[model samples]
Target: MKRIAVGVALLLMAATSAIGAGYTWKNLNPIAVGT
Candidate 1:
């Protein structure tokens, strides 16, 4: 049970990190284009 919980937490962290990176890139593009 402890291992499963840890695995789930790691998975969530990775997923959120990936999502945040993609989102930041998306937000940056328009500013880059405008410049």
Candidate 2:
């Protein structure tokens, strides 16, 4: 039970961090860049 809780906590942390970073990128530039 404790291990499962820890795993979920870590997963949430990782997901939030990724989302935060991704949001930064997207907000900064949501433009398609290719030529």
Question: Best by lDDT, which number?
Answer: 1
Q: Give the per-residue lDDT of model 1 (tens digit) for 1-31.
A: 9999999999999999999988888788977
Worst 10 residues of 1 by lDDT: 26-35
What TM value does model 2 have? 0.72
Best by TM-score: 1
Q: Could you tell me the lDDT of residue 35 within candidate 1?
A: 78
TM-score of 1: 0.74
- TM-score per prediction, in order, is 0.74, 0.72
Poorest lDDT segment (10 consecutive residues) of candidate 2: 26-35
RMSD to the hidden true structure, all candidates: 3.6, 2.5
Backbone atom clashes (below 3 Å) for every candidate:
0, 0
